[model samples]
Target: MTKAYFILILTSFVVAGCGTTQVKRGNLGKVIEPQESRLILSTKNIVSVGDVMLRAGEYSKEGIKLETETFNLKDSQTTSVKHKQHTFIFSIPSGEYLLYSQNNEGSYYASEQPFSGLKGTKDGYGGLFVPNGSPSATEFYWNWNKAPNVLFAHQAMLLTPINGSIGKTSSALKNKNASIPSATLTYAGVASAQVRFVYKEFTADGYARPAFTQEVSLDYKPGGTYAYKSALFKVYKADSTSINFEIINPLY
Candidate 1:
């Protein structure tokens, strides 16, 4: 069958399923369809996290015109409240898409690892970790143990120190008490010494953040001049098994 004819038939299936089908967008800014196929382009930039843009090929009598479409990851204004920006609302149809350029800003905290949303050749639904803020903000206690020679240096946010317990924490510990060194006590006792570690409270802005971006190309047939710009995406295929993309871009 011809490309245009196939697209026509595919549109029917999409329209028929619209009533019952629900579209879900992920933090990486891509539409997630478990039993369907599509493509999305998004950035990790905090200012533009909710906005997604893609470079598409539009066939014209002169040549294939390059077009851009920007949309919010959210589907509705209500959902956009938390997301914050929604210039366009649109979806992507199933077809081969290509990633030509990718820039991954490293994670803010050394403990938190940064990731490029979609990687290599992948099929089916996927999620990308968008750094909204520090991985965590709440203060918690850890390294609960007893010390022999009680050398309690600091106090914990929760749970009072019983004897020689320390409440050293992971991230909060560093943020609050950078001057305090790990307690090195002289433990002479044998079978009854536990240590406790504490993590103090902190805010999300305590650490730095990362912003990533990637440029992708959608497959389109090379005909007519376009009148206006739109989020128009033709349904090229309907089979959920037909969608897949190869990552040819770097994440740096």
Candidate 2:
């Protein structure tokens, strides 16, 4: 058996979000949807060598509005609609980065922590799970309670890096990257309460990277469907997440 790591090119759709502030970072710049998200790379920065860490949603649910109704306890009522919309603000100066995704084959381990989508490694359904093919402009949410080892809720997006050419990164560069030490990438938004990120690294396939969980939607949709566009949770990235990951050249 052979393992294959890949960098695939895919199309993107841009959606501009109104500028806002992130709780963790305070005031940032324009809000970026999955399309507007990109990696800022340069010949100078070593720590900035990957796509922006995907931002977690302040609100767990999207495209759902509450309809206001007045119940007279005996008669009828009137109502309005209210939906929670939040923007992800980036403070980390945009630069070189690689898009990261977990959960291919839609691996949603209710008991597995990190929900790093690595259980496939043990089950032998190919390898680490992720988007087995091209992904569309859709939002992904993880019932953190359902994601094994996860204690929070999270809304994640499937995206690509601005420049995607992470073929073989030499062990020397990986060594250098290791020496550089990893820093936490952050965005900004003030969470009301009941949310925080616990950072830890997990090894899957062959690459080792930090894994963290944030609270998103408290509600879990068990039947494999969202209220809005039914994006396939099983497939996340455009490339197959299976295959052995041999770290000949490592890029984060």
Candidate number of the best lDDT? 2
User: Model 2: which ten-residue window has the lowest total lDDT?
Assistant: 241-250
The per-model lDDT (C-alpha) reads 0.21, 0.22
Q: Name model 2 segments beyond 4 Å from true.
A: 1-86, 91-101, 105-130, 135-153, 156-166, 171-252
For each candidate, what TM-score against the reference? 0.13, 0.17
- In model 1, which regions exceed 4 Å deviation? 1-10, 16-111, 119-169, 172-252
Candidate 1 positional error at 107, Å: 21
Judging by TM-score against the true structure, name the best candidate: 2
Cα distance off (Å), candidate 1, residue 115: 3.3
Q: Residue 44 error for model 1, in Å?
A: 49
Model 2 has an lDDT value of 0.22
C-alpha lDDT of residue 175 in model 1? 20
- CA displacement after TM-score superposition, residue 29 of candidate 2 (Å): 30
Residue-level lDDT for 53 in candidate 1: 16
